[model samples]
Target chain A: MSAWGMIKTIIFGGSTLAFFFILWFYNPFKHVEHYEVEKDVKAIIDNPWKKTESGKTIAEEGRELFVANCSSCHSLRYDGIYIMSVQTNPKWKNIEKTAGRPVYRYGKLYKDRFFVPKDVYEAFAHDDLQSLKASFGQVPPDLSTIYLARGEGYLYEFILNPQKVLPGTSMPQIFNPQFDPQAKEKVAKIVAYMKSVNTPPPQEQFKRTVMGVVVIGYFLLMGLLLWKYRQNLLKRLGYH
Target chain B: MGLISKFIDWIDERAHIREIYRTQMVEYKVPKNLTFPYVFGVLALVTFAIQIISGIVLLLYYKPSIADAFDSATYSIMGEIPFGWLFRHIHATGANFFMAIVYLHMFTGIYYNAYKKPRELVWIVGWLIYFVLILTALSGYLLPWGQLSYWGFIVTTEIPGSLAEAPIFKDFFKAVAETIVLWMKGGYVVTDVTLGRVFGSHVLIYPLILLALVGTHLYLVRAAGISNPDGIEYDKKKNPDKFVPFHPYITLKEGAYVMWYLAIFFFFVFFHISHFLPPDNFEPANPLKTPPHIAPEWYLLGYYEVFRSIPDKFWGFVAFNALLLLLLLLPFLDWSPLKSARRRPLFFILFLIFMFSSMALTILGTMPPTPQNAMLGLIFAALVFGFFLSLPIISIFEYGWYKMKTKGGQKE
Candidate 1:
């Protein structure tokens, strides 16, 4: 091969390697540690009402607080209301199993019924806040995604004083620790529960071993191809 | 009979597949001097194929309704489905690369003056492809229902509202613009109805149009034959060695480039998926609360800068589309006898300046809109406009000067 041709190929191959190496180091898809709520900050004055537990333990306590307080308005799970409705309704079994069927025919009604359990129907009344909607003219947003959309910091402040954080907002301050004892502990548990509900599953980081194998395999095949095409490549480059 | 041969014969008899392949793939001739820039044409097709396949997979999980669109796209596609992030990243980043490759192909064609004489139709079809592609990308941008996408649509659609302010036929013009914008959104505001219609147009209507245009473009390329890189017309009798068959020779060269291109593509997909993303898009759309700053994807920012720089809204709308109009008029406007910039010193310098100005304007568009920045934007916008406007006059002048200097001067 001409010196110029060899130089060009080396430059191209080296740049390609360098480019991918940069991507390997700077990858956005690398596993990112998600946000988690802090459960305990030591009270400066040793407040007697504090739980003084780790965040996960506090969230465990918060589950009961959330069901009693937040469940009347904000839903805990995504589509919890829909699932509750499906359990009580009787027409859940009519959906066809045929392939290529138009999906809208099942509508919102029948689709949820397919997944509802028979025991759930007998256990609870339809749990959605339909009456709240009748009075307010707006259904409250589901809280399944609250921790994700607004970080734990916002949730803590909003719970303490809704009017102070967001003026003219519909949400009222539901807890006053001074007026009601144990309100502070209950609020902490609810915040912890909100954080626990929506934390994403951790991503598997891209493996260097797998990439090394793929690159080595690719280059091996490429080297063989280059050897096979040496004559044709030279001829095409006008060396002949 | 062998099983493979039987299957091939069955399909081949029904479709005449081999005949089509032999004619289109095997016998086609490309210029021997074709280089990396030439490969972008096929690279564009490669990226576009990636987009369509990944897009189809995404559509299976994506809900078009307002309430569900954001959650469905984010939760189902990114959080729920297996390897869903991979598909979503490929589709999103593939769209950007498709436009990037198309831009490279278009600019390379311009630098070589490929639109001269016999290839005007190919050039026109390319512009049309670009137009459809912009609309497709814009419509697709809103499907995520994020703050940036919502605001970007609002700003772009409001450009039409400027038409109402025109002097002579102000009311009629305003009515027409409003009607078109409303038709696009299916309402006065960007809501679930807007999302549904935009999604429909993005996946269904625009692709159909783009497919037809691309078919015509490829047919024209085969008909006209690939242009010589140095801008000399191909003559078989003069040097038959200058042409090579597409299948093995050109195909092999392009295959290597495709490998390199895919490496770059995967680099963005893996590491820099957010390279084109505005951070504001992480927040869901809130009609009551507008983001502090708004901008488009980087590719369209140059024109967006021009639009924002103009204080007069009516003139800004006119100027925005007029830039595209200038591109459409390029073949006729450039009256130079010479075809390639390689032989033209003055034009090459000007082209460099034009490219720099365009890049600068794009960067400037992302900065806070201040008077000083706006002034710079206006200056760059004028330079870009002048570059297109002066093409014919400059070509004529330069060619005349060359002829005067050397009576025997001829383009090699």
Candidate 2:
């Protein structure tokens, strides 16, 4: 090889190594939280407010409290608790048409069973973003997917003091200790409920694991076959 | 001898299949001196195939509208559809790999002087394909309607808007810039209409242009024959030993390279998916809230740094585009009779400078645009431009020196 070629190789190889090293050191997405529902459930169960004197699970009590306090704005659609009325209702038939058949069926199965108040459902079904913003200063986000996006820790902090966690947030401190004495327990339970509902179903995990294994294995096998075939061909060509 | 042979014979009689195959594949001759770097072009084609297959699968589930685009792309496909996550990762990672391979292929072409003489059209067409690929990538990046998608779109589309600050024809330039940005965004701002426009262009328009350009590029390659690493033109009839048929030799080699590429590609798909997906992109588009740090994907970072390095926005935009234009005009700019840099120390040094400066600029692009970084970026950007602008002069000197050495009883 020429001196230039050697220099090129050294520079390319060194840069590639340096790039990978930087990627390892920085780890750009290191802070991204990966939620595991079972771990969260175990944590909730081990908490001091695991069960109320009424013998309710934390998640169960959280659900009741969420409906009374938070459900006026936020909807738990992942838990089959959409704020919108049932798809079968005449006023909501357009949602069925727009959302397609599967979603309509989902709405039919879940929306009818969930007991959202008439007024709240009416406001949501009418697509009343203007009034919602006027009331809360901003339209509230759906809580169903929030657990996965923000994680339990951030949610706990945000719920405990909305202004401190996210200044100018539309959400008020609903569980303020000045107004509600059981603020800490309520925040814990709400987070627990969020975890319970938003935890990915086991089938999703199984599918990802199985698919990843199969794909990687197939590629490995193919690569080995190709490597063997290449060696044979090179030998036949008198190049080995 | 059985059904397959009979079927092939039936088709051959009607379509002249044997003649086509013999001309395009069986009798096609590639230079024997070609090394592993030669595989990068074929690897690029393979990566494009991966992108097309995976992209089509993604399109089946991708929603183009703003409201549902994020949910459909993320939750509906990744969380609901079977093996959708695999295809999504494959498509995303394949794009990155595609750019990497194309860069390697282009560098290989430069090293071998593959763009000289009859192969200029091949280089030009290949560059067009590359340019359109960048467009397709930029447009597709916005389809998911993530925060990065939206904000990245804003940053890229707003590049031309820097013309508003141009020293000449301030009013007219400002109007033209505004008009161009508006047209690109499909409105005064990036909105659902912009998403629709990008979706149409990304999947349909750019791919069609790329396909045509790639076809032309391949045809040009075949017509011109492969350039050898030694940069010496050899007649196949005069030196038959230096040539080999493309069928078993080239095809099998490409297949082996592809198999290795696929292994590494799948490893990224399965394990290092986060390498392609930035964390800020996890959030859906919020026009009101801009992420603190926004950068284009790694492939475009060099140009992005060139744009950022200059103090004046108008000049930065000019320099940014001038860099790409200079690269496209490389065959014409470097007028040396000798194609390869192997024997020419000046050309070799210039190539290294170009390569190092571009790499430096790319690294600078990813860093925060502080004054010191910007200063470094400016210097590297100047080096990149300097390499191209000085190429013709250096080529003249090298040619004169080569003549002197050859005249001094040196064997050509």
Candidate 3:
């Protein structure tokens, strides 16, 4: 073989082997394990709320305030509504009991029945939606998952003065030092309530790890086979 | 004859398919000494295909609206759709890889002097394709409506506003810049309208332009033929032994390299997915709040640094554009008979410096514009321009030395 031909073979073989070794060496499962554990510990340490002067936890005070004030517009039962409907709604119950075959057939219907709020489930949901939109200029978003999406700091600022934080926002300034003396504490409590109700989505470590192994293995095998085939073909062509 | 052969013959007779095939692929000859770097063009095309396929798959679940775009991309697609995460990962990673491979491909072209003489159109078209690809990537980045996407869009689109600060024609330039910025954002600020416009451009407009450019680029490559590392053009009729048919020899080699590329690509897609996804992008876009440090994707960092290095916004914009224009005019700038840097030591060293300086600029681009970082950025940015500006002088001197050496050797 010529010098160039040998270099080609070496590069081809070396890169293929090196990439495969790198893929095998970096175990995604182990990384995911460390990532999730660290995240959980961080979350625990990062909890900001404290007990009030009255011995009430901030989250408890926030929950009471939320029920009195924000509950008129925003519902804290977003995910709960879905879970409750799945268990108690006759239509959903029938679909759930039918196992795989009917579930597949009723997939579209199942999706529709999945996430109905308490007010929507009760009566005149469409009318209620229009009225709510008419009143607020836009339908108020559920506060249940707001904490997960917007961090505590943003939630605090937004709840304290919606207009100040987001100019042109339809949300009214419900809590302020001018209107209420303990407005800062009230906003903090609201944020604490939001944080307490919402949990981040569970880490899919098992699925991701399995996928990483399978995908890496498949590519590694394909690469080796191609390398072998290429070498043989080049040899036969008298190029190697 | 087999039925397939008969059918092929019928098609060939009418369309002259055999002639086209013979001229284009089967009997087309390239230099025998072409090496590993040549495979990057093929890898780039493969990455393009991956992006297109995965991007289309992602579009199925991607909501272009600002309100739902984040959740649709993350919760709906990544969580709900089976192997949807894989497609999203591939699309995201493939975009970065596409830019990476294109940079390598461009470097390979430069190193081999593939942009010289008859291959200028090829380089020009390839550059246009690179430009469109960046635009497409930028537009696509905004589709997720994440924090980085939102802020990055704001920062990038507002770059044109610096034109208003130009010393001359202040009002006219200001009006034009403001209009352009407003038009790009679809309002005074980035919003739902901006998302819609970006989505339209990303999926429909930029891809169309890219495809057209890519087609022209490939045609130009075919017409010009591939340049080799030696930078010596060999006519097949004159020296048939020095050339090989591209069909099996080149295709087989490309296949091996492609497999290697895929292995590394999938490894990142599966294990190091976070490399493509910045943590800031995990959060949905909040127009009220801005990220502390907003930067473009890794590929655009060098240019971003060049923009930041100059304190004046207007001059920085000019410098940024000047760098791109200089790169495009590389063939015209360096007028030397010695095409290959291997034969030109000075050019090779300058090229290395240019490459390192740009890399340094890219690293600096990621950091906050501190005094030290800004100073380093300015230095590297100067080196980058210095390489281009000094190319012609160095090339002329090198040519003179080469001529003298050869003439002296003949006398001896």
lDDT of 3 at A199: 26
Per-candidate DockQ values are 0.09, 0.25, 0.17
Estimated TM-score for each candidate:
0.74, 0.85, 0.74
True contacts kept of each: 0.01, 0.24, 0.27
Residue-by-residue lDDT tens digits, candidate 1, B1-412 = 6999999999999999999888777676677787566888999988888888999999998888876676666655664566676688788888878877787788778877888778889999999999999999999999888777888898878777788878788779978988977876678877667788899999999999999999999999888888876778877568778876676676666666666667667666655665554345656676877876677876798888998898888888889789999998898988787777766666776676676677677777767788998999999999999889889888888778767766766434
Assign candidate 1 its CAPRI class: incorrect
Order the candidates by DockQ, highest first — what do you get? 2, 3, 1
Q: B237, model 1: CA deviation in Å?
A: 3.4
lDDT of 3 by residue, A15-97 (tens): 53443343234423122211121343234323424565778766667767777777666654432222222234466444433
Which stretches of model 2 miss by more than 4 angstroms?
Answer: A1-10, A20-70, A76-79, A83-128, A143-164, A167-170, A173-203, A237-240, B409-411
Candidate 2 lDDT over residue span B304-356, tens digit each: 99988899999999998998899899999988878786666787788888877
All candidates' chain B TM-scores are 0.93, 0.97, 0.94
Query: Where does candidate 2 chain B have its weakest 10-residue lDDT segment?
Result: B74-83
Model 3's TM-score against the true structure: 0.74
Error of 2 at A152 (Å): 6.0
- CA lDDT of A153 in candidate 3? 62
